[model samples]
Target: MRIAVTGSSGLIGSALVRSLLRDRHEVVRLVRRPSRAEDEVEWDPKRQYVDAAGLAGCDAVVHLAGAGVGDHRWTEAYKKEIRDSRVLGTAAVAEAVASLGTPPRVLLCGSAIGYYGDTGERAIDESAPPGDGFLADVCQEWEAAAAPAVEAGIRTVHARTGLVVSQKGGAWGRLFPVFKLGLGGRLGSGRQYWSFISLADQVAALRHILVTEELTGPVNLTAPEPVTNREVTAVMGKVLHRPTLMTVPPPALRVALGEFAQDALSSQRVIPRKLLDSGFAFEHPTVEDAVRAALRP
Candidate 1:
């Protein structure tokens, strides 16, 4: 299949690109700068422009370009950056594909489990309605931005991703070194449930969604079983052979992360109902399994 992918340099995107290439699938990388290679296409999400000709004849488009939510302290400006990056970038990709004479068969727009904000211990799935919070609002807008492609009769799927369990990047990337140094511990009361998936499963799920014709709406990319922050701490310590003796208080987290701390400490017990129902299998099904996969060379 010929797939055009944005955010090809990101944690999940990079891995997905590698997997697709390994399978001999042609990949066109959408970059913000000038196209430097035959597989490169220039796009400007800020202006909502994509080189339609570059997208022509592609079988699918995986739009994943967005600002890192945890990359900075949540100042009001940085929050806006997060929202604009996802919403605008998705709109650009959607519009471009819709304008193509023959639109891509599938449009997988990146989303997050944050859409079901602070679900506490209650496990949720794709059937759940949008929750309340900054991220939930942003996710709704982000997914809606892909309407152009959907309205054009294209198969649009919103991949509501979870906390990726990989040392290569994302929140887990920062946790590995801290845990290895024996500074790892639970955050706050450590009771918040964290829905997570291994990097390998994440990429595979994206590809599954791309090929699964019946999947057209929101599909979670999380594991079947979700673990709490305390459980994750234990697994990290056990897998890394480190001591989990420290505890980060909620107050300290608030001071350290600002508004983002609320999200960090939020509990979301999400399940991959759609993925499982669609016959997608997870390479790492448990927190321990994910930690071990992340430790692989």
Candidate 2:
């Protein structure tokens, strides 16, 4: 199959591209700058533009380009950056896909588990209603931006992903070194639940959604088992053979992360019910499995 993917340089996108290529599928990468190669297509999300011609004949399109949520302190400007990047980027990709004479069968738009803000110990699935807070609003707008593709009769799927368990990037990337240095511990009270997925499973789930015609709308991309922050801390120490005795209070996190701290300390026990019901299997089903997978060469 021929697939076009934005955010091809990002952690999840890069891995998905590699996996597709390994299976001999043709891949087109949408870039922000000028097209530099045969498989390159230029897109400007801020301008809401994409080279529609380059996207012709693609069997599917995965829109994952967006600003990293934790990459910056939650200044007002950065918050706008986060919302605009996803909403605008999705609109561009969806509009471009919708304009195609023969649009791709599937359009997978990136989303986040943050859509369910501060779920505490409550388990959430795609059927759950939207929660409150900054990220929930951003996520709602982000997914809604893909309406063009949906209106075009394309099979649109929202990948509401959780914290990926990979050392390559995301929150886990920062945790590895700290834990390796024996400074890792729980954040805040450590009672908050953390829904996480190994990098391999994340890529696989994306592929699953691409091919599964029956699946549409919002789908949670978390593991079957969700662990608490305290549990994650224990697993990290066990996997790294380090001590996990430190703790960062909520006030400290707020001081350090600004508005983002509330999210950092928030609890979300997300479940991949749709993915599981669609017969998607996880290679790393447990937090320990995820931690060990992240450490693998």
Candidate 3:
């Protein structure tokens, strides 16, 4: 299949691209820069511009372009950047795909489990309504930005991803160094459930969605078993052969991370009901397996 992908340089995007290539699928990377390669398409989301003709014959398009949410502290400007990057970029991709004479069959847009806010001990699925919070609001708009494709009769799936467990980037990248140095510990009360998926499973589930015609709407890209932050810390320590006795109080995290602290301390027990129901199997379903897979060579 000929697939057009945005955010091809990001952690999950890059991995997905490699996975597709390994399976001998053609990938067209949407870039903000000049199209130096034959498989590249130039697009400017901020200007609300996309080369619709360049995306004409693609079989599918995975829109993953967005500002890094946890990359910076939650300053007002950065918060706006986060929202604009996802909403604008998604709108551009959706509109572009909608304009194509022969539009793609599927549009797998990126989303987050943050839409559920702090799930506490309760487990939630795609059937749950949107929750309240900064990230949750961003996710709501982010998913809604794909209305053009949905309205155009395209099979649109909102990939509500969870905390990805990989040594390459995201939260795990930061955790590796701190945990290796024995400085890693649970945040807040450590009771908050963390829904996580290994990098391998993340890509696999995405590929599954690309072909599964029946899987549309909000599909949580998380593992079947969601563990608490305390469980994750224990697994990390076990994998690294280190101690996990330290704890970061909620007040200290608030002082250090500002508004972002709320997210770090939030509990989201997201479940991949749609994916599993669609017969998608995980490579690493447990925290121990996820941690081990992340550290694998």
**Residue 171 deviation, candidate 3, in Å?**
1.1
Candidate 2: where is the Cα deviation over 4 Å? none
Cα RMSDs, all models: 0.6, 0.6, 0.7
lDDT of each: 0.95, 0.95, 0.93
The lDDT ranking, best first, is: 2, 1, 3
Clash number by candidate, in order: 0, 0, 0
Cα lDDT tens digits, model 2, 54-124, are 99999999999999999999889999999999999999999999999999999999999999999989888
Using lDDT as the measure, which candidate wins?
2
List residue ranges in candidate 3 displaced over 4 A: none
Poorest lDDT segment (10 consecutive residues) of candidate 1: 72-81
> What TM-score do all the candidates reach, one by one?
0.99, 0.99, 0.99
Per-residue error (Å), model 3, residue 50: 0.7
